[model samples]
Target chain A: MNVFLQELRSQRRSTLIWSLSLAAFGSLYLLLFGAIRNDISAFEDVLKNFPPVAQAALGFVIGTLKTVSGFYAFAFTYIVLCGAIQAANLGVGAIGREIGGSTADFLLTKPRARWSILAQKALAVLVLLVATNVVLLAVTIPVAAAQGPDFDAGLFVLLSATMFFVQVIFASLGLLYGVAAKKVKSVVAVSLPGVFAFYIVGLLGAVVGEDAIRYFTPFKYFDIGYILKNAAYETGFCLVAVAVVVVAVGASFAVFAKKDVQAL
Target chain B: MNVFWRELRANRKSLIWWCVGMVLMIYAGMAKYAAYATSGTSIADLMKQMPASLSAALGFAGLDVMKASGFYGMLYLYLLLMVAIHAALLGANILAKEERDHTSEFLMVKPASRSRIVTAKLAAAFVNVTVLNLVSLGLSFAVVEQYAAGENMTDEILLLMGAMFIVQLVFLFLGSAIAAVGKRPRSAASLATTVMLVTYVVSIVVDINKNLGFLRYLTPFKYFAAAPVLDRMGYEPVFVVLSALIIVASVVVTYLAYDRRDLKL
Candidate 1:
């Protein structure tokens, strides 16, 4: 209980920054929807002139750039990118900082069991992430509706909710990396590359038109284009995301329980 | 001189990893171009098939993306991203690592002056980015040419790489400037990367919304946009002057800030 609260309190500043940034992107872009809608034909011509490959790389979808939901869904890719970084940072820092900062000795010597410690840390990250998503939803949904087009409220919620789903998957992988690494000198170093590698994987998969490759990268699990059409996520990918969380979080506990903190 | 060589030797392993990573990235990226080139459709027609939604999404598409130059021009955006990140992290970490690793005292106690050390470390970072740039240039030449199908796209690739070098230099100095000015040694790299990301987002937003075209001044990415540079338009003169200003200012800031700060230890 103490560790959970302490973790939340310690991480309050970064959490707030990430939440605000996420919420800001949602509001800022949707507000622009009105201005852009007035000049749709001109905007379409400009988009046509931009490179196709670059468009795919930026997660732009051609079929839906005209609508509010579609535009926000497109902008939501950048949001997901940011949220993944924050999640990865939080997860890696959860246990990695204790070992890296050489504070594991003091923390481990306390009376709590190792599993209990891990549980509290994981729970704190979950709470923080949920709070971020709530803040994002609260800001984005209302602004999106106010754009006055036929806003698909249900679909917008579905698309926005994927932020949490992606965050959970990355956070688990980050935690596992945190526990498995011998000692981490810098949390950003580990998390940033991991996030970018997956991102590029998703981008390349789109470039090659290879749907099978999507399974390898979490970024592909929630396709904004597909969701814009089908109004749902791929069942297979969602299960894969769940499996990843289960395996990674489970492995973190197993390794962390037996690990010797004194060796570092 | 010893400080420069020592910095090079210390950064050797990571540079090798960066090289390997760049090689794979180029290969993977060019592989897409090869697939596009041979798909039995003339590159021009294939591109014609792709809808001009970006015009719908934001502005004008002028490049003939079916050509080797056009495809490579598109690919350069991704390359710019990688190099920008490497330069930013390299610049921030080169100085800040000493403090983070608690070796600032050991280095500061050396016979060299603080400016001399900064120059040496920055020189090493210079070499690192140069090698990475050349590696990209060489591989881009090889792969983009393969798909060039005898069109002689070398000049196009060179122009793009040249622009890429300037972008890398801008970010490297920007990173060093942030590290030198920041109070916390550990947060220097994060701050540098954050600055890099914000500018990148600004560039993207500008690309998507021409109304924000004024923001081109704020980001290095817009200074030499791939499509414009590859189109024989070349780097905009105004952005060229801005890049130069940023580089010179950052160098001055780094020297002035690092010289006066007390060592963390």
Candidate 2:
């Protein structure tokens, strides 16, 4: 319990920074929608000229370009990218700090079991990611509502909720990398490429119009267009996402428990 | 000189990984182009479907995707991103690792001046970026011949490579400057990554909306946009000079700050 609280307390500042930044980022996009709402038709016409591949790559849907909700969804793609990076950073850094800071020995010397420590760290990360989502929703929801009373409040909530799901996936992946890699010199080094590679894969899947490829990248787990139309996630992809998090996090705990801590 | 060699050796493995990663990415993207070219998917049909705003935002404004140069122009977006991240990571890691790994005191006591140490480290990083760029370019030339479409794309390819090199240098220096200016030397690579992401987002935002056109001057990604480079077969003199100025200013700042700042160790 002390380990959990300490880890949580230590992470508070960064969690706050990431949450505030994400809120500000989402708010900025929502604010931009106001400027664009009046000129949506003009914007749609402009968007209509885009190549299908390009549109797919950017997650832009012409059908949704005219509505504030549609525009928000478009902007939300990039926001999710940012949030994924934040979560990946947190996930990697959680275990990475112990290894990179050469404090794994110090941590291991405690009376608690390694599984307990891992659980506490994982809990800290989950709490922080949850808090981040709450702050993001707090800022985005009211601003989205202000756009117009007709804004689909339920759909907007559903769309925003995907960010948490995506974060969990990336966070688990990060934890795997943290435990699996021989040494992580920088958390950004590990997470940036991981996040971008998956993102690019998602973009390429869009360009290729390949449904199978979509299942491979977490960035495509929740399609805003599908969600807006069906008002729900693709059950298969959601299950795949949950499976990934569970397997990866489970493997990380197993590997980290037995892994030898290198003396600095 | 020993510092330079040490930096080079330390970065050797990652350099090879980056080179291999970039080569594979280019190969994969170009292979897709081959499919796009031979497939019945009409280039014009695809172009007509794309909106002007999206095309411009993606740096796809002027190129005809059917042509090799145009295709390369489109691929340049991904290449630029890969190279920028590589260069920035190299620059940040080279400078910040001493403090990060708690080896600052050992290095500080060496028979070398801080300025010389900084120069050697920066030089080593520059060399790594240069090697990665050259290898990728070589691999691209070899792969591009397989699907050249009979157009002379050599000049445009060279120009684009030059622009990428400049972009890499800009980010490299920017990363160094960030490391130099940071007080505690914590996660300089993360800082560099964030800066790159912000600039990239700004570049895309500016391209998507004409109202934000003024922001084009801020991001290094826009400094050598692919369309303009392909059309002109060269970069704009203003952006080129501006990039040079920024690089020079960043290097200068890195030197001054690194020389004066107290090492945490």
Candidate 3:
């Protein structure tokens, strides 16, 4: 409990900064949706004329620009990317930095079990991620509502909820990398590549129009367009997301338990 | 001299990885272009039916995707982004790792002056950035030729690569300057990445709303946008001057900051 509390307290500043930035970014983009809302035909024409490669270049996938959910979906893609980065940073720094800096001697020597310590750390990250999603919704909802009269409240909330799942997936993946590497010189080194690689893979998958390719990258796990149309997630990808989290977190625990901690 | 070689040797593996990634990116992108050319399907209609929410706005204006250079111009956006990222991370990592890994004491005790050391590190990073650029250029020319159906895209590719080079230099120095001046050496790489990504997002936002055109000056991504530059077939004079100023200013800052700072060691 102390470990959980300690970890949470330590992470408060960054967590606040990240969540606020995500909210602010989304709100700012959502506010601009008003300009596009006034001209549905013109905007639809612009989208029709725009090339897919150019859209992928700008990281601007997710369409239906004429509708509120449509525009929100466009902004939501980048939001998810940022959320992934935040989760990756937290996860890698939590485990990798502690062990790499040789501070694990102080941590692992405690009377508490290793699993307990890892659980507390993981729990803290999860709780903070939940807080990020809440802040994101709280700030963006009113802004989104102001722009479109037909704002689907339930749909908005459901879309916002997937951010938590994405964060969980990235955080778990980061934890896996945290323990798997022999020595982590920089957390950013591992986390940036890991997160961006998945993102690029998703972009490439979209370009090639490959459905099976989506299975390989977590960033593509949720089809925002499908969600907006069907009002639900694809069960197969959802299950895949769940399996990823379980296997990643499970392997982290197993490798971390018996692993040698090199003395500094 | 020794520091330069050592930096190169240390980064060799990662450099190889980056090179391989670039080669694969070019090959994959060109392969898709080839498929589209031969498949006889309309891409715009194809995009709409596959998933509307997958992509909407934020695109280059006035390029026929059917043309070979047009497709390469689109691919250039991602290439510029990837190369710029490599430059920034390399710049910061080279400078910060000394203090970060607690080797500042050893490095500082050398007979070489701080400015000389900074020069060496920056030079090593410059080499890394250039090598990546040339590797990208080579693959791009070959791949475009194979798929371009006899269209000569070499001149346009060369121009785009030149613009990309300036971006790489600007970001490399900006990153090194941040590391040189920042109190938290550990955060330098993340900070640089954040700055890079924010500018990229801002560039797209500008695309979404032309009212934000003024903000173009603030982002390097817009400085040499593939569509405009390819159409004009020349670098924008103002952006070229701006890039030069930034590169020079950042180099000055790197020297001054690293010289005066107290090593965390």
Candidate 4:
């Protein structure tokens, strides 16, 4: 418990940065909502002014804006992309840094077992990520509530929780890479583009009709659009993400325990 | 040349993935556009179909999906932004990789001068990016030509693709400069990613609200107008030239800076 607290404190700055960034994103969406909330009719009138050719260029039909579904379609796509990037970035250096600095040995050499060190680090980072999502939801709920729309708080919470799982999955995957790689440089170099490629695959899946491929991306499991509309969790997808995380983390510690740690 | 070849060799997988991913994304985008194309839906029809809320969300106004440029505009622009981000990080990390790996001392003790080494590394990074872009563009063109071709595909698309390449080049060099100047490899990568992401976010917002027009200038992306390029068959050569100047300055400054930098990793 003491060790966990110490590690948490050490991670506070990164946690704050991450939480604040997510908060800022939530604020941006609120601002988007506010724009329409101010004068819904006026906004519609402005849309009417654009030429048809100009209008088709935007992609979405304006009539859908009358419902929350409309907002989910357009805004959630960007939001999911942003959130995925955040998750990927948070994971990229989290495990790689510890392994890269050769501090895993020092940490493992302590009174605790090797598994404890890995578990504690993973939990700490996951907790930070989950905390950030909580802030995001806290900010979002009030703004959504203020808009005279009966918001589904449960759906929102579930969606936010899914974000935590998404982070865990990526973090575990990154940890696997960090543990396997011979150097930190190679880990980061390999992981950066890998994250973006996954994003592209997910985005393509979403745009096209590849529901199967969407399942491959962590983003698909905690889909913002689906949650917003259904006001419920997608249980099967969430389970898949969790199962993957558990497997990856278990594999990571197993590998880390045996691998030769070259301390700098 | 050894450094150049080594970088190319090391990055072969990345290069392949990026190119393939870009091609796949572009194909998906054009396929979406083709759906609209078949309906004989003028850009206006597509606009009318758009959810008012969605328009606000995507920040789309005066967008016509019918025009090839418009189709590419809605479809390909974001991909270009993604490519640029990838290119920037590729430039930064690849250049500083040896130093970050704690191999700089070993390499620096070799026969080559630091300047030559830096130059070769930069040249390798540039070639890698160029190949990635060319292949992405070529593959996209091939896919578009093969799978779907009904609308007027013009020189504008070629021009837009070219401008996008230039913007990508600028991002790469900017990343290289940050890598050279940054204190840590992670810091360098973070700075490059942040700059690219912020610029992209600002570019989206700036286009949404022209009152913040000045912010667009801050993003290297703002210089290329794919719509105008696709529609007019050419873009402002001056902007292309300006972007080139920035790329050259960034690469030159970063090379010089890295040469004199103490290997402190």
Best by DockQ: 4
Candidate 2: tens digits of C-alpha lDDT, residues B106-166: 9999999999999999999999999988997888788787779677767777888889999
For model 3, residues B8-67, the per-residue Cα lDDT tens digits are: 999898888888878767777777777667644455444433321122253434455667
List the candidate 1 regions with Cα displacement exceeding 4 Å. Answer: A35-62, A206-209, A262-264, B34-53, B56-62
* Model 3 CA deviation exceeding 4 Å by range: A42-63, A206-209, B35-58
Identify the runs in model 2 with alpha carbons over 4 angstroms from their true place. A31-60, A148-150, A203-212, B31-68, B144-148
Q: Tell me the TM-score of each prediction against the true structure.
A: 0.89, 0.87, 0.91, 0.86
lDDT of 1 by residue, B55-159 (tens): 424322556656667667766777888788889989998998888777899999999999999999999999999999999899988777777777987777788
| Candidate 1, chain B, TM-score (2 decimals) | 0.93
Question: What local distance difference test score does each model get?
Answer: 0.82, 0.82, 0.82, 0.68
Per-candidate clash tally: 15, 6, 6, 18
**For model 4, how does the per-residue alpha-carbon lDDT over B109-228 read when each residue is reduced to its tens digit?**
889988888788778878888887787667667766643457555454567677778888888889989888887765677678778877876766665445577776678777876555
Interface RMSD of each: 7.1, 6.2, 7.8, 6.2
TM-score of 4: 0.86
DockQ of all candidate complexes: 0.24, 0.25, 0.26, 0.35
- Per-residue error for A47 in candidate 1, Å, reads 14
Q: Give residue B250's lDDT in candidate 2 (0 to 100).
A: 94
- Per-residue lDDT, model 4, residue B200, is 78
CAPRI-style grade of the A/B interface in model 3:
acceptable
Highest TM-score: give the candidate number: 3
Candidate 4: stretches off by over 4 Å: A1-10, A37-64, A67-73, A145-161, A186-188, A206-209, A262-264, B36-56, B59-62, B67-69
lDDT of 2: 0.82
Ranking by DockQ: 4, 3, 2, 1
